[model samples]
Target: MGRMVPAKAAFAGLCSSLVGIGLARFAYTPLIPVLIGAAWFSPGQAAYLGAANLAGYLAGALLTQRIAARVPVRPVLRGMMLLVGVAFLACAIRLPFAWFFAWRFAAGFAGGVIMILAAPAVLASTPAALRGRVGGFIFTGVGLGVAASGTLVPLLLEAGIAATWCVLGALSLVLTALCWRSWPDAGVAPATRRAPPARSSLAARAVVLEYGLNAVGVVPHMVFLVDFVARGLGRGIEAGAGFWVLYGFAAIAGPMATGWVGDRAGFGTALRLGFVVQAAAVILPILTTGTLPLAVSCIVMGAFTPGIVPLVLGRLHEFAAGDPAQQRALWGAATASFALFQAAVAYGLSFLFAQTGGAYAPLFAVAAAALALALAVDVVARAIGARQVRTRRSVAA
Candidate 1:
């Protein structure tokens, strides 16, 4: 245990996640107007690309289970980074819509692998005493990535979208190389992970349901939040950039806050609170789009949403008995759920906005509804699990 804090694991995990998340997911929001203006994509195309990216992420998540089981996590993470670089470079070509979609999918797949892999690996490697702090710091890399992209993409948008993609790809590759070099090879444990729930259907359905509800709540923020500000709120690039910076910082803080809370209290409490925070965060900014309220919402969303899902992931370990491969699969599936929900929201709202002629408030209200539903589902699941634990205790007694 003392030897396990390999600098490589921490740096590689953080670097891989930053590039994967930044280049793949967070970049889309800022790139929206630029792509729309350049005539490279339509609203439909944008939504599809997001779905496709998540599909790719799902694939990567699946692939990671295999890769992590056979090979060391360090190399797998590095390879994903390089793959992301390729996908990023390919996006520079003013290819047909199909080609761009395919490239985006590949980026999503690679990025997903990095995100899914880095998250668990970071958490698993840390000593029990320091897990919360390290996890907080590792998760913050996502904010770092989001902040960088938000700030830099506008400058790139001033250039051509193609140039922007190329530079982003180049930057990711550089980071990947640096982190790969920094990473030390951690030992692999080849033993089969714990058997997943024997009641397969029940577990599967619960996970899917849990993930789906959470996804619906998040998509509005992830896909349309920035665009809402730019288009509906009438706040342009600076507002968009500033909003995301606030979000990124908040994301970095969220895991740390929750991690501490989890350490002090219980994981369930942290997760429930996180979902509540997410609902408020999305709703508050839409209700009041000024600097102050938006800033608060940004912090709220950033600190809460991104980290809560991982808390669910941790909970899965308790039920699944810490089976690494199965845990990875669950996370990959969750990411897909996240994307699909976002797509549904975007597509659904695109039509609604077209019809109703309302502001972002209505759409945000929809997101809030979704989060509320997710919280309900989570509360039910937590209650059931608690009951089961009590039953087993009673039987043993």
Candidate 2:
């Protein structure tokens, strides 16, 4: 029984993330065309509806820490999961544009709250040696949810759209029930008694900036990769969905692989390498439209999408010197930054897509540029941090 406690807590966190982000957000991607084809919403309206989720995500990220401060972590996590299931069910019926928008937003908000609170809640109680592995496992839920959507959403669509949403809602509820008793009784509030080191603060800020830019970098693939494959390349929805499946499969490997690497090579090294590889992947589509190239792009981008989260989380843990309170505060700030950039870039890309008569290439080009900038920022920040360390040692001598 004692041996299983940490595993159970990790499983609970995974369920929260799976429902919060995996199903709540990615499930809507493949459904974009269905919503349009069925005359449920115009293309423009459908695009904006996706953006609404990001907007709500931003709101949720900004508020999660504050909410947790006032409430216990376990119930907040469970309630957010319940809210997401409810949102999925609410989205089943084709109501007014406002109705769908609001539900998507609510679902997104729940996802943000879950994303902010879940893993940290588990990690606080995790043994130090296992933090990376457990953190990686917790985030696997996002990929599992993504993979399930890619394969399951299509099968569910056969029964019709409304039924599909209802099924997703049902699955979420079932997972929630299974994990209801698994959460650790840890509070998420950061301690106000001590400030983090000045150098750590600087490094954390640099990492946060990089993470926000990464959010911009991923928007192209996250929001439009399916549509690009489906319509831009003249492939049908099934083919586009095949790419999403490839993405999902790659995503499944991303977190675990990266976490293993972080546990050995250091999170900073893993993250820097990831930025380079993902930047290349993001740009591959613009350079070529060949079958091999697109597949490679999808796989690489998919792996890094959720993979990078664990690396960042692990890195923040390092920066905080394993202080849970400081780690929680830094992570909350990082999430809000990511949410802000993701929402802004999502809306900006949607507008650009419309303005350019649905051009997809330029959007990817812009994303690649954002990633390149992120890599440069990380390098400069690391250099400065290293210099500060050397100087401090010299003065002490």
Candidate 3:
């Protein structure tokens, strides 16, 4: 579209994601192996800790939405960003499991608030036509954060986990400060005060289903990829870190490419392509242990996992049109649904992983199947959209 979204505003949105999602959420993936190696927790306990974050995220999504109904979003967003940094600092205290869980949970909660608000804020500032590209650029912060974690965390691991936690927290505050002034002060529009429709249409329902399925499909990699690569593949921690870095790089690329495709072809088309590739990528490590396949798998998985979110959110944004209130509600519901599925899978798969004697193949199989199902649902949604367009044209004629 016209010049894409503004560079300064888009970069601020990216930094919000960097602190909220990249540092708060995805940073845990590479840290999973370290937590195991340090004996702060066993694999199963560590999984629970991770699950706790998702649980908090789900709760935060619901709570944030409820609060937004009554209060302004910008203040909440700023408060959440501060909380994210504080949560990270609290994690460095090295308390009991319950305490650690609470801190992580709080971080996830803050992260949830940031995720729900940041996209809407950024999209609201930009032209409707440029939302897709702006969304892509915003998510690149996640990839950058992931890449930073992959690269920086390992180096920081040399300093010990406590130190690492403090450092990460400090970095989060710095990023938060940088983006502090960027959020819009305009409160929720008066029109947004009226509640959204009681029932969603079939297309909206299908979109929610697709979003949930994608969440399930991502679990194997998010929680277990480094573990699978290091322990399962017998590659050791460094190789796993290398794969993580590859994934981070790919994550950055995937969203940008998807944005370009969405701008030209359509968001639906970009999503379909991403799902197919991601499904294969999820299953690739199990298919062959060769270096090339594994690397390709890591890169593809990295790119599409976060890449899908912008596409999904873009479509949902379109559904809400100019209604800020509806957009907030939609984002909250979509994110909560995604977080619920992810939390369920995290807990369930941990138990399964323990029962299966740590074999990762089955998890990959499940992830691939979820992605396949998501693709199928997306296809149906696209068909319905096309049919609706045709009907409208006919009526107009």
Candidate 4:
């Protein structure tokens, strides 16, 4: 029972993330052109709808911890999963733009709530030594959803868009059922005490800020990558989707690979390295859009997309110092920060894409710049932390 508990909790987290982010958020990427082509919406409307999800994600992130405080964590997790499933089914009908937007927003809201709450709920039961690996497994659901959507969306398109939405909705509900009994009922109870002061420490703030900036770094690829390959670069939708598939495959490997690195070299070190590599990848399109360069760019960017989540979580766990309540609070704040930036950037970039007349290079350039700035902030924060440790050690001596 002891061993089974952790395993089941981890599996439950995985299913929640797969539904919340994987299908709810990422599955829409490949469908942009399909929505436009089917005359369901114009290109600009499709882009704005994508932004709507991020807006709802922001709302969910801000509210999750507060909701968890009043309600049990397990029911909240289950409800959010079911909400995402229903959102997909509701979106299947070809309705007014407002109707689709509302459903997309609902799905995004559920994703944000799940993303904020699920990992911490599971990790509360995970052993300290295994948290990194367990977290990696939990987030791998996002990549799995991505890979599944990338591969399945095109095939399902043959049947029609409504059918594709139905299939995704059904899959989400099935996953929810499989994990229904697996959640840890007592793992993430409401906090009755105040968090430690360390929650506001320099390193903790830096991690949250860096996470927010990462949201900026990812917006271009998340929002525009498929459209860029399809319409901006003059590749057909099939070729664009091929790149998206490549992205999904790379994403599948990202979290586990980074988690292994975090366990060995330390989460902080892995995070800095990720920023540098991601910056390089984000800028590749600006320098050249050759097939090889684009492929390399997509592979690297995709891997780090969901890959950074576990790294950030592990780093924050270290700061929380084994206090599950503090960890949840810290993580909630970090997630809200991330969602806020992501929502703002998504809307801003969508506007920029329109202003620039569908130009893609500038978008990538902006993303790369955000990553570079994140790296700089992280470096300064680490330096200050190390110096503070040294000062404290000297004083004790």
Candidate 5:
């Protein structure tokens, strides 16, 4: 029973992570078009702000290694919650685009730190058997957050964009308070790195590639889907918002409901399945381009990518290398790579979307093709990684 207590605490921490990182932070993607319209920022300027946010995210992820070396995970996670709230409020106040960029940048860092930190605690604390399911529920917070933001922002926009900002900022604060109330207060792990050979081994590189492929496979859903539903479907803002709601809810369902299956079935297989589903879903928008197709595709996208995050993180435990401090630095680098891939795909699609006036079939087809490509690459990488791990074990024996 005493042993079960940390698991319970970790679950609470997971909730905090969802609110800070998943809900407050990730919701920005779906809100991207709307924010540009409201702030009168150029698409280029918006892109810059988005990049700035990713940069901060990179910094936070990198720093988690140092923080974890000194403190336990839960306290660090709790502190991040409050800081994330402040940063969200900073964005809500509508700073100059430059300052807003900085604040969003900071928010990204805090969010990355919070989510990354939560994983180690969950990993260390969760029973290996149950880890995947709990991971799914924890990850569900992202979809829930995305869905909440998607649904909340549009509803508030109906009242005015200012109202929308206030609502998001306020929700973050509430989450911060909830975090403080529920857990020990500390920042994330400290920064540290391991010295291996100057270059990474093939296995590390493979892990990075697999993560990057996952990012590419999901980019269209991240960047273009909202506009696709709005402009392509001839829906108003309400309908556009509803499309995100569907997407976010589906994302939540993917990780939350099916996470256990991934744990039992294996993340690699789960990932392949997710990629196939996403490929099929992206095709839906291409073929039908109707409200129903759009909604279904959103659900499919959510299932594939959302499950990928927790699964990858969970698998990190399999070949634990370096000090725990260095482990997070490794993971953060991988995350930065993931974010970089997403950014490139985002602006690329935006350019394409503009060229076509959101014709969408090309984009959806391209996205499906990307996911298939990723899925193929992952198959090769995972096979090699598995073989190498088995070889090392045989040598040790």
Candidate 6:
């Protein structure tokens, strides 16, 4: 029972993501078709709203870093979850584009706050040996969110978009209430204060660039995979929903499996494996047409999507030479950079789809290529680190 306590705390941290990310940020993907069907906005307008949320996320990521030491994370996390609930309810109001954008942006911002705070706090509270497992558990919330939204939104859409939005908001409120006391206190871990690495460090550059590219990798699945399955492939909405549910369940496995691998093989090696798997997953749908193939593609994509970040974060800390401060700074920078890249890609890919008359093949291809590039960058960074070590050894000798 005592052994189960930390895992329980991790589950409480999971609510931060279940509400902030699962409901607030990711629910939009499955709900997109309903929004268009209900004529709440045109497809193009919806694209902009998606971009707006990413923009808000970027702002929030940056702000979390700046206020890390000054602000208590638990209160901020609770407040952010509450704000996410409010934003979801606000979406139900028949508002003009500007107001809708504001609400979506607010939700995105709250998601960012939860992402930045929840897992780090959990890691701090947990013993070192359990850190990897706890992280895997916490991030599984992303998949849970994806699964919940995929399953629930379709049923709720029967009652119209407004009701769907309100029910989701209410669900978030209930979750927030249930997990209210689970998170660790503010001082549990170094949520904010980290030593900064030198600007010219090879590992620093590699991790930052890898973080940016990681955002690109997720864009295809997160933003367009559902539409691709349902509309592009003529699979229908039910098929799309099934794929999403598969993605969620598979994603739950991704972090747990990969976290164990990272513990055994090392974070850097695990991350490289993740990059290869994710890139292949992105390209699988493009290469095949059968139901089974597409379903496998969805599962592969889903598993890797939420799992990779914890690995990257682990790698960042590993390369930070045991400096807690540097680890924190790099984590913040990576988070902010990821948000910025995602925001840009959201708009750019949307524009590309519009220009090409909604052709999705090119988008997935681009995302796969971007992941390949990230992997290459990590390889070079590792090479640089090895060279630096050799030079230091020669001097000492």
Residue pairs with clashing backbones, model 4: none
Q: What is the lDDT of residue 387 in candidate 1?
A: 84
Arrange candidates, best TM-score first: 4, 2, 6, 3, 1, 5
The order of the candidates by lDDT, greatest first, is 4, 2, 3, 6, 1, 5
Taking the tens digit of each residue's C-alpha lDDT, what string does model 2 give over 19-38? Answer: 99989998887788788999
Evaluate residue 329 in candidate 6 and report its C-alpha lDDT on the 0 to 100 scale. Answer: 69
Judged by lDDT, which candidate is best?
Answer: 4
Model 4 misplacement above 4 A: 1-5
Candidate 4 vs candidate 6: which has greater TM-score? 4
The 0-to-1 C-alpha lDDT of every candidate, in the order given, reads 0.69, 0.85, 0.80, 0.87, 0.67, 0.78
How much is the lDDT of residue 212 in candidate 5?
68
- Which is the winner by lDDT between candidate 3 and candidate 6? 3
Which lDDT tens digits does candidate 4 get at residues 1-397?
Answer: 1363467888898899999999898889778879999999999899878888988888898888678778778888899999998999998988899999999999999998899889988887677667777888889999998898788887888999999999999999999999999988655676666666774399899999999999899888776887899888899878887898899988888887888788778898999999999999999999998999999999988888889999999999999988877888789889999988887887788789889988888888889999999999999998988898899999999
Clashing pairs in 6: 194-325, 195-325, 195-326
Model 6's alpha-carbon lDDT is: 0.78
> Where is the poorest 10-residue window by lDDT in model 1?
186-195
Put down candidate 6 lDDT per residue, 1-397, tens digits, no spaces. 1373465567777788778877777788767756787788999788778777887888888887666666677777778889988988999998898999999999988888778777776665455555556677777787788787777777888898889889988988887887778776634343454555544378777878887897898888877877898899998977877777888788768777777777678788888888898898888878986888877778877887878877876776566555544655677778888888888887789889989998998899889998999999999988988998899999999
Note the clash tally of each candidate. Answer: 5, 0, 0, 0, 13, 3
The TM-score of candidate 2 is 0.93
Q: How close is candidate 1 to the true structure, as a TM-score?
A: 0.84
State the displacement of the C-alpha of residue 12, model 3, in Å, after optimal TM-score superposition.
2.2
- What is the C-alpha lDDT profile of model 3 across 1-397, one tens digit per residue? 2564556667777888888888888777667778988888889778777878887888888887677766676667777888888988888887788988998899888888878888887787667667778888888888888788778887888998888888999998888788777765443332236547623356666777888889998888877887888899888978887787888888887767677677667776777877898898888878898999988888788887678878987777777766777777787788888988888887788889989999899999999999999899888877887898899999999
